[model samples]
Target: MCEAVEKDLYAVLGASPSDSVQQLKYRYQKLALECHPDRLGDVCDSEAESGRRKFLEIDAAWKILSQELQQAWPIDSIVSLEDMTWDHDECVYTYCCRCGGQFIFSEEELPWRQGNDDEKKRNESQHMVVCCDTCSLSIYVKLSFV
Candidate 1:
């Protein structure tokens, strides 16, 4: 049995986070064709198994990327604090995004946000973290409620 794990699906598909939906689909298709086991009619059994695994990974990545869409408290780029890599400089908290963009959440934007950590945790939380200005990718920062 195969269990799904949390992974950087974009990396699996050889795609950047900001790639358009069309671009992502294209990449998935290309990888899918390349990795298809049938493409290797005379390969060894092990190689065929490897190709099947590769195809599954590519297909799953596309499914995840296509489902989600979304942004900020002056976050400059929309994203969640948790999904980001934290960096503290002076009074600012900088979050390094997955798409290689930075979302700046300063103390100034704190007031605009909901509440404290406890309250935020008890309730649901989502933030649109922007990936990069060059492309249209946003990090979906979501905390699921239990």
Candidate 2:
């Protein structure tokens, strides 16, 4: 996977990582309104472009930060791949969530599922973060290809 250069989303919105979601939302809204392209009326072309770019960055930052915040609840559990139930029909491994939802992992989604035996050995002890499909709860799953 190609990783894009990561910008500090918190810094982009003049926020600290410790800020509450509400605070982040407030900061994002304030910055977004101030730099919105349409709000930057009658500015020179360069200034307009800069405003647009800033607005885009702020918008992107909010999107990522909001999702992370929503999923930031304490991890419900730490489970190993062997603890999950496998469904041959669906080709997925599932673990029941406290909310009656399920945390699903597919074979294709496993990094160690690909590559050579050496690569798989290196990834024998890997981790995957999965969220409950119907709730905010998440779990850390220890993965093994053995």
lDDT of 1 at 103: 45
For candidate 2, the TM-score is 0.49
TM-scores for all candidates?
A: 0.45, 0.49
Candidate 2 per-residue lDDT over residues 25-73, each given as its tens digit: 6688789888999898899999999999999999999999988776685
What are the Cα lDDT values of the candidates? 0.58, 0.80
lDDT for 53 (candidate 1): 91
Best by TM-score: 2
C-alpha positional error of residue 35 in candidate 2 after TM-score superposition, expressed in Å: 27
Candidate 1 residue spans exceeding 4 A from truth: 1-5, 70-146
Q: Quick one: how many clashes does candidate 2 have?
A: 0
Clashing pairs in 1: 71-128, 78-128, 78-129, 78-130, 79-128, 79-129
Query: What number of clashing residue pairs does each candidate have, in the order they appear?
Result: 6, 0
Worst 10 residues of 1 by lDDT: 69-78
